[model samples]
Target: MTAGVETQASAKVSAPSASRVRVEAAAPRPNMGWIVPTLYILFLMLPIYWLVNMSFKTNTEITGTFSLWPQNPTLRNYIVIFTDPAWYSGYINSIIYVVMNTVISVAVALPAAYAFSRYRFLGDKHLFFWLLTNRMAPPAVFALPFFQLYSAFGLIDTHIAVALAHCLFNVPLAVWILEGFMSGVPKEIDETAYIDGYSFPRFFARIFVPLIASGIGVAAFFCFMFSWVELLIARTLTTTAAKPIAATMTRTVSASGMDWGVLAAAGVLTIIPGALVIYFVRNYIAKGFALGRV
Candidate 1:
């Protein structure tokens, strides 16, 4: 009897129930969800890849015939950009103003955002709306006004002039973003700091700012990106001394006409700074989007 029971148990273990096998067969395979995003990414990367490919080819190869890859690759385009004073100076000028603008915008926005998040004053909403309106207005509207004003002060072609001009747009955006993050922080922390005899500045600097650091990163990123990319006003307010890379690209014509190779190389170089900024701040930006606590 014991031998019969042991043999029956072994048979049951050796063969899974027909129902279990049917259930396993019925399980759905994973859908190709990755396909759409992969295609979309490829679509976006195509132009960038083409630009890089063209940057290596000579102008003769670019226009003379269409090719996926450079038949005879050369670094002449990149060499020209690095070697030429005018070409390289444009990049320097852009960085000078962009960094200045990001710093100024975030600094100004922090105090204003703190007030908005913590205080409840008359017309606060109205004032905040007015701040956003400045950002909403097209850069073109202020281009002429800024040019005339900067000229009157003899600030044309100066880095500070461009930095200040960008602040008009950047400050409001920074303020809006920082306000949202500040609001997420509980007011109890402020009360606790005060009870410990901490001054407003001391508490803000030592305790409060650290809690909302991600917000600051997000604001600075936007400010840098805006100042780096803005063209019409940057071009209008400057000529030789403070011309940005964007304006320089527009003027990259030679006796043979547009230097396509050089332009492509410059474009590839121009994307590097913004890419680096995003890479460094990517984590902070993610935290900021989640309101730092979510």
Candidate 2:
């Protein structure tokens, strides 16, 4: 009787096991998860790939043919960009102002953000909202006003003019970003530093800054991008001496028609600075995003 009972229990267990196996076998398999993302990436890459292809080909070939790849590869487009004063100087001017804007924005924001995060002041919330309002306003709204103001100061057509104008937007954004990161840090840190007889500047530079380095990187990255790609303000404030590559690309017309090859080459070159910035700050930006600190 005990043996028969044991056999019955074994049979019950085996029955479910067999049923589960059969169900799994009959279930439809899922399709590949990567297909959609892969196709989307390829779609986005098409324009950039086409741009690079055109950059390598001569204007005649570019206009006459619609090849996926360059038929007659030539470096003449790149050569002109590198050698020509107008072409290369735009790159230089852009880099100068971008660097300046990044530095100034981050520098100003660090102190302001620290203040906002650490201490309460009169109209602090109102002040913070006002700062955001500046960022929200379009660049075009400020462009003409900036142009006129800079003109009065004889600052138009100068790299500093663009850099400083960019600060009007960048500083507020930097402050907002840095404030969020700073607030995440414990107030005990500041007290601890003060108890150890560390001054504000030294403590901020040595202890506090390192802790929020990711936030600074995120802020600086944004500042660099805005100053780099901005056209209207940069275009309106400068006629020639400080024209960005963005403005230069628009003026690519020649007597022979549009300098399509050189324009394409310039477009390719224009992507490099932003790419470099992204590569450097990608990790920090990722952290900022993950933590919702930005």
Candidate 3:
């Protein structure tokens, strides 16, 4: 009887201790994971903060001193950008070409990527390398040839000219990214779709496309970014009517003087399309990198 009572007491004591231990173990620890990310975010945002601040200031304030914030904040810069047809037209032109470049790059790249991912043909490896080599070539090397080629084709100074020119680099990059993501998808899915009496085109359009949708988003974002920022080829391809925002920015700085306020405003405006694009694609970026297709 005495031993049984002692054993019960010991068991009761140990059970509470075990439960306490488990409760403690299940609790989250203080992590330093946020430290590096926080610092990196601050670093990236600082330049943007400065640009926005400077945009609000007058030319005198901007030239006079380097202030963290504008002393006398004004919307004149924005007003100028909105009111001027020339300034706004550049934005419109840029949008047209950038969208064209992105659509063409992704549309062409998707099939090429799918081919590379799914099949083995003669010299397929060589072809893939050749396509990627276009990206490796310096843009300067292609500028003169592109100019002459577009001139010959009567595509010079057109949005299509800029869009096609951008494809020289963007298409290669899009293909590579899409190929990586597509390769990660399981081949079983294709087989299953085939066994279910789905036609190749139907299966690819319905099943395969959705599986790698994240990859498509990522490729499109990169294509848009590259084509948007590229100035050399854009300038080379288009003269006035289809001139990109980058070339228009050059007009601000000439032999006479720089239009600081207008330039700042243009710079800020240039960032908007990219920012909105990234915002929309931000969720897919992680999955895109993971190449996680069902």
lDDT to native, each model: 0.91, 0.90, 0.88
Find the candidate with the highest lDDT and give its number. Answer: 1
Task: Write one digit per residue (lDDT tens) for candidate 3, span 122-233.
Answer: 9999999999899998989999999999999999989999999999999999999999888988899999999999999999899999988889999998899899999998
Q: Over the stretch 194-288, how does candidate 1's per-residue lDDT look in tens digits? A: 99999999999999899888888888888998899899999999999999988899867888889999999999999999999999998787676
Error of 3 at 48 (Å): 1.7
Give the worst 10-residue stretch by lDDT in candidate 3.
18-27
Q: What is the lDDT of candidate 2?
A: 0.90
Q: After superposing candidate 3 on the true structure, give the runs of residues whose Cα lies further than 4 Å from its correct spot.
A: 1-30, 254-256, 290-294
In terms of TM-score, the best-performing candidate is: 1
Better of 2 and 3 by TM-score: 2
TM-score list, all predictions = 0.88, 0.87, 0.86
Worst 10 residues of 1 by lDDT: 18-27
Worst 10-residue lDDT window for candidate 2 reads 18-27
> How does residue 162 of candidate 3 score in lDDT?
94
Q: How many residue pairs clash in each candidate?
A: 0, 0, 0
* Per-residue lDDT of model 2, residues 75-107, tens digit only: 999999999999999999999999999999999
